[model samples]
Target chain A: MKEFNLIQRYFTPASLAPDTLLGVGDDAAIIQPPAHQHLAVCVDTLVAGVHFPKDTHPRDIGHKALAVNLSDLAAMAATPRWATLALTLPEHDDTWLTAFADGFHTLAREHGVDLIGGDTTRGPLTITVQVMGHVPPDQALRRDGARPGDHILVTSTLGDAALALAQWDHPNPAPTLRARLTRPTPRIAAGHILRGRAHAGIDISDGLVQDLGHVLKASGMGATLQAGALPLSEAFRHAMGDGTNWQYPLAGGDDYELLFTLGEADVEPIREQLAGQGCPATVIGRIEAEPGLRVLGPDGAPLTLEQGGYSHFGN
Target chain B: MKEFNLIQRYFTPASLAPDTLLGVGDDAAIIQPPAHQHLAVCVDTLVAGVHFPKDTHPRDIGHKALAVNLSDLAAMAATPRWATLALTLPEHDDTWLTAFADGFHTLAREHGVDLIGGDTTRGPLTITVQVMGHVPPDQALRRDGARPGDHILVTSTLGDAALALAQWDHPNPAPTLRARLTRPTPRIAAGHILRGRAHAGIDISDGLVQDLGHVLKASGMGATLQAGALPLSEAFRHAMGDGTNWQYPLAGGDDYELLFTLGEADVEPIREQLAGQGCPATVIGRIEAEPGLRVLGPDGAPLTLEQGGYSHFGN
Candidate 1:
């Protein structure tokens, strides 16, 4: 398809607000936030062979790139409003572009975010998405606000993505396990719920232990995760026997769930509200005065893992 | 240099502003914009084989990737404040990473932009940068504001980068020509000068004519270009005989210069101010009440040539 044709067919959806002075057809997009809202911006990139397996579906690739960035907005306790996509492709295959846009637009619209601006270039199969969300300046949650007495909570089960990845290399894994790796849902609503209440927050891209380590480092505090309180999906348990699954839960990447800290007094009400919305909430840890992350195993001693979570360069 | 070590050494420069609440080392950077200013954001990616040659210098790749995005910010007349880099490499090579960061940091620091947050992944070599700048809500330039009879102006000489690129496959034409392709000077100062004066603008990434095509299409107007007025760098002229250089001037990509439109009344004063600042400004076209771009060759007939721009899917 031609460039303008590709834009009209896959972009320029009504989900975008008219407040956007300029969107996809220019050098860059122009947007103005509502009077009381501050813009929360972040970018993430996914390469063909690096972020996902080479054989992964194009639709999933599109979903995950935007999903990972939405996860960033979630960590900030912001409401995602708009996004710009920078896509570098080997060639313009109409079918691939369509499926990719389908995946991206469906999720963007569902989250009430619009595709505002982007650039398409001829290059390798790489997708970079910059997401912008709106938050009242005072209510935007960040990783620097955790206090020693705060309660650390995580949304939904962990390790399913990592476990699913392990089974991904297998020729045939169960359908459920495959979908977990292919299309993990980002907890958007849970983030909105925690916006005003969370003291600090972050999305788990590089496993719970490593990602939480970032929050601890930023907040200048420590954390102790309760091993028994960790939530695991059935798919996670099936891939790694009960005990082994804990390692993946703590170190496996690509969960896209929010790990946030809230004031101890606010947990009960927040948890009830989240439960009302049919989202999972678990108090897995607590913030501490010190500055290192530790995990207490089921036996109540520090759990030692062979390696830390996935690093870009690999541990 | 390992990923973390490289980040700490090269990427973690002190922020220029006190309001920079967060700089690198976190999942995302945080900053409080001045109360009166709005944020302008843009992202651009350069792949090794597609955007540049496979064996292109890492330093040049780093410079161009950031320069291109900065050019976008410049088009919007935004003062760049922060950037996030996402690099995907095939392996963990110390030399390459060090040089890449060195090139990136040098330009970033010069522009007062800090590397706030980023992700490093293992894959084919690709660099994606998302840059954010500050623009007063009422002062940001856009591509849709050009009115009929506006004078279209461009900064510096055009077609040098394209000529330099053409020389790439052959022999190095000259040091001046080579530098044009290898090191692009984003029109930051010129953009700042034209901020409130220009009615609309866009950086010329896809050749002067094609990019201006975007401005015209968006403004719902037409343009008439003076072929003789196309600015030619000394190196471009040396490479192209005066008559033939028109092709390069009109169609070469990678120039990263600002092509903007100003009201007829503001032209003389803006030009005088820019001249005082030691920047060259050229008025080569005029926005018309009609609705298509027309180029008048030396003979004053409509000029039509093959499309001279790059598109993601267009060959």
Candidate 2:
């Protein structure tokens, strides 16, 4: 599709918060900072050969880029307001640009986010999306808020994306497993519901076990997760056949779901509220005043594991 | 020059606006959006093998990436508040990361922009920077404000970047031309100075002749320029040997400067004030009542050219 055609078909007529004075199709985006809120902005980059395989579909690449940034916003409990997309394409293949723009615009609209402004240039195929969200003046959620007695809960499942990537081309892998790898959904609505309820939160992009370690470091607390209570999709169970692939679920990356902590009194009520929306929540662990994380089996014994999640610069 | 060392040495100590609550070295940077000012945001991406050559120094790559976005802030005449840098690298080379951070932090500090938040991922050598600038509630500079008789003027010289890139490997082109290509400074101070004084402005990233086309299209005005008056550095003259590489000057892509239009009455006074700061100002064209651009020769004849400037997707 042509550039203007793609924009009109996928990006126009969206409902942004009252503060977003102007949306997409402009030289720059203009936002009226809310009366008592501060804007939180972040950017994420996904390169063709490094972030994803060269042949990864354009739509998936587009979705994951925005999904990751939205995940950052979720960690802060910030309500996303606007986004700017900076896309670098090797060539202007109509089909690819059309699919990419469709995926990006659809996600933005679903989250009530506006596509304000960005730049497009010729180069290796890479996508960078910058997201802006709003948080109440003094109440922005942070990784530093977990307390000694906080309940550590993860929304949805963990390690599904990692499992999917491993079996992507494996013979006879079920369709459900492949979907986990290709179309992992970002929990935007759940994130919105989570605000004000969670003390500290973060989206699990890099395996649940590894990313939570960051939370532990930042909050100065340790965590204990009951392995049996760890959410696992059916696909993950099937892919793990003899359970040898279990490490994939604990250390894989690219699951854009939120991992958060809440006060003990707030857990059951929040779970009930989430169930009302068809997304029953799970409490997998608890934060201790200690300084490290330990995963436990049903018998309360430590579950020994070798690998952690993927690290960008870690060897 | 390890990545950690580079960040600590250069980026950590940079000055920041009073509202920058936390800067760099975190999962995400936090900022205090000024009480009454709105935020203007934009993102731009540059990729090796697309935006620049793969062999280009990491330092220059870092500089250009941030410089491009600073130009966007200049377009709105917004005071840059904070920036997020998302870099995708192929490996964890300490020296490369250090050089890149040095360039990024230096330019950011010079413009009073703070590095608030960002993500680092393993991928192609790609850089995406999202910059946020503050404007009073209703006072952002825009592209849609040129009047019928506003005079159009460009800051610094044009085409120098395009020329520089063309001769990037030349043993030694003129010093000015090489600097323009390797490091075309963004008009950060000039942009703030022009706020409330100019009607509309935009940074010249594409090319003088083409980028100005955006302003013309947005403002619904035409422009006329005296051929000999297009800003030309002595380096530009020396690089093109016979001055025939005008295409590099007119269509080159790396110069991060500003192209703005102001009221005819406001021109002389603004120029005089800028001159006091040692920044030479030039008025090369005027906003006309008609609908397209024209470059005039010495005898008042239209100076026609084979091509206008560089186009991202254009062949």
Best by lDDT: 1
| Per-residue alpha-carbon lDDT of candidate 1 for residues A1-315, written as tens digits (9 for 90 to 100) | 013435655666665676665566655566666665666667777878767888888888888888888888777777788777777787778888888888888888888887876666666788878787777767777778889979988888887887777777787776776676777777778888987788898888888888888788878999889988888877666666645657778888788878889887899999998888887789998999988988999889999987777777654
Kindly report which residue stretches of model 1 are placed more than 4 angstroms away from their true locations once superposed: A1-9, A144-151, A169-172, A219-223, A238-244, A262-264, A286-293, A300-302, B1-9, B36-38, B137-139, B145-148, B169-172, B241-243, B299-304
Query: Candidate 2, residue A167: CA error in Å?
Result: 2.2
Q: Which segments of model 2 are wrong by more than 4 Å?
A: A1-18, A24-27, A49-56, A171-173, A238-244, B1-18, B22-28, B238-245
**In candidate 1, residue A265 scores what lDDT?**
82
The residue-level lDDT of candidate 1 at A230 comes to 87
The DockQ score of candidate 1 comes to 0.38
Candidate 2 overall Cα lDDT vs. reference? 0.72
User: What would the TM-scores of all predictions be?
Assistant: 0.89, 0.91
Which 10 consecutive positions of candidate 1 chain A have the poorest summed lDDT? A1-10
